[model samples]
Target chain A: MTVNVLLLLVIAVTFGAGITLLLERSLTRIVVGTLLVGNAVNLVFLVASGAAGRAPIVDPDDPSPMSDPLPQALVLTAIVITLGVAGFLLAMAYRSQQLQGDDEVQDDIEDTLIMALAERDEASQSWEDDTGGEPDEEGADR
Target chain B: MTTHSAMSFLIPLPVVLSLLGAGICLALGHNARAQRVVGIVTLSVVVAIAAVLLAGAYRDGPQVVHVGGWPARLGIVLVADSLSALLLLTSAIVTLCVLVYSVGQGIVEFGPDTPLSVFYPTFLVLSAGVSNAFLSGDLFNLYVGFEVLLAASYVLITLGGTGPRVRAGSTYVVVSVLSSVVFLVALAGVYAATGTVNMADLSEKLQAVPSDVRTVLQLLLLTAFCIKAAVFPLSAWLPDSYPTAPAPVTAVFAGLLTKVGVYAIIRVQTILFPENHLTTLLLWGAAATMVIGILGAVAQSDIKRMLSFTLISHIGFMIFGIALASHLGLASAIFYTVHHITIQTTLFLVAGLIEIRGGSTALERLGGLAKAAPFLALMFFLPAMNLAGIPPLSGYFGKVGLAEAGIAAGGWLAYLVVAASIVTSLLTLYAIAKTWNRAFWRPPDPETAPPIGDWHPSTPETPQPTGDWPPSRSSPTGTKSGEPWAPTLTAVRQLPAAMVGPTVALVALSTAITLVAGPLFGIASRAATELGERTPYVTAVLEDGSGITR
Candidate 1:
């Protein structure tokens, strides 16, 4: 199964850029990242089919060693799915923007709550904090 | 010949009926009554169809159907082996119960003024996707099934488009998309290496692929599923996102979605990559997931959030069973998946009831639920105890099965995970007990007493004082978590019979799993045995006769 280096490079670059974008806080950039990654994966199907040949239409008389049609068919399905997901993601991004005036993902409230609880525990248990959250009553010792 | 045609007809009905039901529900959105009827009827029919298919698979062999009259090599196949049938039945039952609960609670209903008339259709669509995933014999079809369910879940998660929901939904959507993309890449790699995505074909074809490429494919596939299944490191998104959705949506997702991921893992490990080179790796993942996930559970102050962590923790048990890679291991894993699905969903539904009764799920804001509503408390108690794997329950049996498998496998890693699983179970009990004591057993906070009979639209309108429920007791500035901080409402009236009925039914079903644990485990072992054999599945799909050339 011979493969082209150029196609490989395209997949590599596109996937790399997409992943970098995906690490951002903003939902718009994440959507762009997802779209880019999706396209790169579609190209993966192409590369997987090896060096491209004639369009995959079966004909007895016109046998020109066509590329595997399966990957192409699969790519079509993948494209439609990606487009649908991208549309839904864009809608969500718009909604998030409307709700809070930005599309950046918020920190998990549960995590924040748990961290606060841990800090509160640390404060109460620590010997350094003589006040222990009651400054007037306990700080006189200090 | 008749039976063959019959199998084909029965195989597609679950997905087809649900989709048709969704379309009808959409068309009848203006008529909520008609829409509800269509949805309920459609799901009820599906449940029956699934049961019939399960009976057939158990009695006969794996039932294989090629869609659109295309032969196995060229077209999609839906195979109802024992495993798929069992899951199909369990999922069908759960989805229907959740729908009934949602309808009774009016959780998924969009009113005349509400712009989104999507709830019924989306719910049905979600069920359709679940059925499709369980039944799909082709890998790409499996992917499509995942997309369908995920797309529906995106709508359900943020149904109201509130600030918190949208925020949660954003994270969920992004994470799920990333996982799907990974799955697609793996699929591309798989096709590049082997020519087919059909599971049966892959079972044979994958053996010829180079070991390194196979390992890479295996890792990518596992990573994709791990994100979906919420295994340890990939699990941070779940507890963060799940508790934000409305209870019914969250319930259904907790019940069915991750199990689908686990099911996929079972398929990949047993069928595609039977060599099981990743046992140590998966065992480590299982141990870490159980310990870390439950630690997070123990740290949570909210009931729903606590359950979310427990859900993640328990996925570890199933993964452990898979890592064992024996008949007992696979059987126990399948059995455990079934048990967890029913118990987890039931617990979430009970959480919803508690929310309605107590007006908040936050432990600080809730107390005396047992005194206020003994029925609701009972509903919560059974599943909560069962989820914690108390003896004489289905959860306990499933755990015992896993521990036995672990002992039989007899590796240091297996022993470690088994110990970790027991500890995880205890931590789960601790979390559930804390929730029980704080939210149910303790007397209502002073601020909540002299209870006003407030009418919450989320519940049936109660006869009482029209005043605002309580005077503000917390700071004037609200917290970002949206937790009330102050005392919410105390239950002074009965929940609607409609709402209570479905929940009772679900609780009863969970209890029924215990009553029939012997037989269900029998079926699960049978399913696992069939899976172990492998030939039944491959031959059923491939040797259908009149098959197209590979």
Candidate 2:
């Protein structure tokens, strides 16, 4: 395949996987999507080395061509790293699901902020009610 | 010793020791005692190797070791220079302190079980990866190092699988993965353009490339690195994610991860692409990072969360030095990186101790800790003052050098850096002071204080019981919970010596750095000199002729 064609394909797959992962709330889908993106990136690296013609080992007796070994080596490392990361991510997801009984991440900050505001409002109302509806501003200032 | 043959094997020794350590840890996974012994022994050996490298760099200059005995252009090479040696030394020291700290904290946090067993091996692997990144002479190897460390971090961050941890870990994972992808894409592009990944070769070759294409590569790489470094606009994920991890994990991450990113950017800017355009961009980015990160710190109520923001902010100061691209600037940047790593980890560890004794990291939930835990308060104070760049601290020396470099680099942009750095320093002080006031000064509420006197001897409440341990029995101390001071005092008095020692050690290190600023500055200057002059690195790798082609 031509290098340009391979580049295009890698870009398409990577972006597709990225968008899919972003859209999904499920942790498993996200991990899978990350894997896809990682593979797509590896493909991009391979393609960038110029369309593969032969293996990188230089055989002096052979009449054929030599491929870029550097990119291949890099891609191999990247793949291993990605696999390790994916395994960890899966473990984390399982653990999360076990703890919360759901895979979806809880929006802790948003929830806490909203709850705190609501509690403050209730407390203010109760204070006013207890003080004969005077709505004491000094205590409410906080 | 001056000859290349003698120095080559020793150049990558630290990384080799660390990797070997990782292997041993993994192999003896079932034997917890053996794992701990191997892990600590290996790290100490690695530290010794780092010392050897530092001495070699000091004596004979920078050295490079090509992996698999290949020439520089064809094979992966690890370079040991003053800068690398300095960072390796700092990393080794911090990791050692953290390892010791983890032994104490891990038992409380993870129990004497499988989780802790799993943790040590991964931690060793992560340290090995970090050492590799510092020593690597090629860009591709650097990327692999980053991936290695990052993979280990993901496991460590979400170890217990608690709800908050999982949620935080997901964000951390996504952000880190995205950054790695971006980094990979950038690497591919650079390789496509240059046909070489060797740092020295790229330094020569990148100059021949067209300005526009170079800029594009520079910006792309910068974007990926900025995300990793948690710089300003890219830093929103850090505060949310970091506060949820186990304290030691957070401490290590805060200490090392972003610094690695900064280190990469520094390498690329000074060694590979010494263009004015990229440096100018870095300058502006540094300013913005400083402002935004401090602002985030100001907004946080949790001690760990606030420190996370401050970590991001301090990264700006390091970047500020690199952006100047002057001797003083680069030297100061290196100094700042080392200083920040020590100070930041110490601060996080102190924060962890606070969470352990006070029951929550949130400032609103803690108070009067100073009276109860004077040592902890002192521990927090040293790093806190150091972080604010108070006079006579290492932080102050680093900032002053950067400011001087900025002034020397004189322009409207330089002035902006000066103003921004000063402002950030002050704001950092403000945020830490807020933590001090609320978490340590204010009186605690008696009703909310954990009961101390009604001791149930059968069951000890784990310091942090979110997961991996049984729920803590309701407070044992019964004083009608009327007075908050007594229980606070009791907990303070009960603070373990194991925890207190590490904090004190870090404080002493910071103080020593401040006291001996001259030697530190000299070392930093040598590092900057070595980094700027790429000839030693290039020559060492390519001289053997095995590195010219793949």
Candidate 3:
């Protein structure tokens, strides 16, 4: 089995772009990234199937050259899985947009506090909020 | 059950039974009682089967069942080793308890045909997924198992489709989807490097592969599992997402889910990558995960969020045991895994009771629970102390076992890890004590007492005429405080026996673990020994020359 440089380059570029999109703040970009990464993974499986030749059919006497069927099966399963998760991600993004007018996940209050403390390099302090303990009404409304 | 005939049938029974139960429960969605019965009965049967499988595997070594009567390495196989059987049993018990707890919560449907009606079925499917992952004999099959459970979890996590749940669900889904993608990529890499995805075959082939490639493959698999496991660095998503769900949902997720990832890591590290190339990395990661996780726990004012953080921290202890790569270490890890699962689930269940009784799990809004419901306080206290590694409890035993293993390893890093684990344990005690002081022991001050009607079903709109505190459920919404803490007892009396029963039973179960620590540790040691040896599993699955297909 020989590695195909052209397919390798394509797979690398696709993965890189997909990861970059995943890191972006926009939910739409993340969804797109997921799809791209999904496709790139499929490509990796395809490349792993060895140099493409025949449709992987089993026959006793007619064996000239046939591609490995396992990677194709793996790719097919991956595609289906990606589709399932991608559809869910898209629906989530759409719902967020409809409700909040933006598709970004706001960091939790505690998460923000942790980040601030880390940046400040402060010792662990009591985080007891004195705002009279009620659930975050703003969060509940949103 | 000791015979091969019984073993084979029992080995796959839990997964198959759970899936069938899920299907049946889904079909009976409109009838809530029927759904509840199906879920409970199915889980109980699974628990029984798991117990038998555990005993059987212990007696006869690993048991394998091939699907469709196909030969091994070609068809999906489910193997019930002592380790898997132990995991299956623990998970089944936790799932059953949580199911009862959810049933007690009164099965509120958000709409006529909402997903809440399907919660029973989804929960069963999640259990099936977990069982499948534990029993799977192949990497690809394990991935399938992970997806199965994950899909069910996605449905369960967003059961009410409330605003907070949906938001949390979205973050959870995105993170989970990314991890699955990474897992797929890793599977491809494994198959590419070693021509098979069947774990038994790969374990043999992987040994012959080059060192660098093997390390990469191992690390890739570890990354996927780590994200699922919520180890530090990849653990940011856990605390944010776990707290918003309904009580039973959160409880089950806390107990059984991350342990599945830890199980997978133990599987790969012991059976496949026996060379221990990444022990140092694992140790460092464990230390950070423990320390950082506990710090996050200490920082949280909310009970559920704090438990979630501690959950991550304790996972570090398990990783430490696995890192040692010794018989005693793995055994201790196994024991600790079982102990933590029970303690964590029990703690969360108690927290749920707190939410039910006190109207909130936020420590700032909660007080005087010990006076209101001493039973609930006692339930919380046992698991809380156990989790903090208090002596004479299972948690103490597990921690001692881990520390002994660390000292036996006799390295500076190991010593550092031991010291960190001890500190984390003490800090965990401090965190739990702080929670107890605020939520239970302290008297409810009239000035700061949470207003009434926060949880009363009659008034979804904020309470009326509660003096100074804001009527808004959100604290910042109102500029006041009042005398509502007195009426909390009325809600406490309304607590359903069904909800309280399951929690009491689970706490009793954890106490039973402590009582029977001797025999339990023996089982853990045997399982760890068998896992360390590795050949028993290879032989059990690949007997009769059912080696690599390629």
TM-scores of chain A, one for each prediction: 0.81, 0.71, 0.79
Could you give me the TM-score of model 1 versus the true structure?
0.91
Better of 2 and 3 by lDDT: 3
- Please give me the DockQ of candidate 3 compared with the native complex: 0.30
Best by DockQ: 1
Provide the clash count, candidate 2: 10
Instruction: Tell me the lDDT of model 3 at B457.
Output: 40
lDDT of 3 by residue, B421-483 (tens): 999998899889878877886666645554654334433333223211111122211222333
TM-score of each: 0.91, 0.89, 0.91
lDDT of each candidate versus the true structure: 0.83, 0.78, 0.82
lDDT value, candidate 3, whole model: 0.82
lDDT value, residue A90 of candidate 2: 87
lDDT of 1 by residue, B1-550 (tens): 2346776689989999999999988887667678778999999999999999999899888898888877787889998988999999999999988888777566222222322258889999999999999999999999999999999998888876767778888889889999999999999999889989999999999999999999999999999999999998998899988997877888999999999999999988888998854999999999999999999887777889999999999999999999899899999999999999999999998888777666567776676778778889999999999998999989999999999999999978788899999999988888787788777766665454323223233222221122111111111121223223223333133465666787898899998899999999999999998888889889888887544666
**lDDT, candidate 2, at B328:** 94
Question: B540 in model 3: Cα distance from truth in Å?
Answer: 0.8
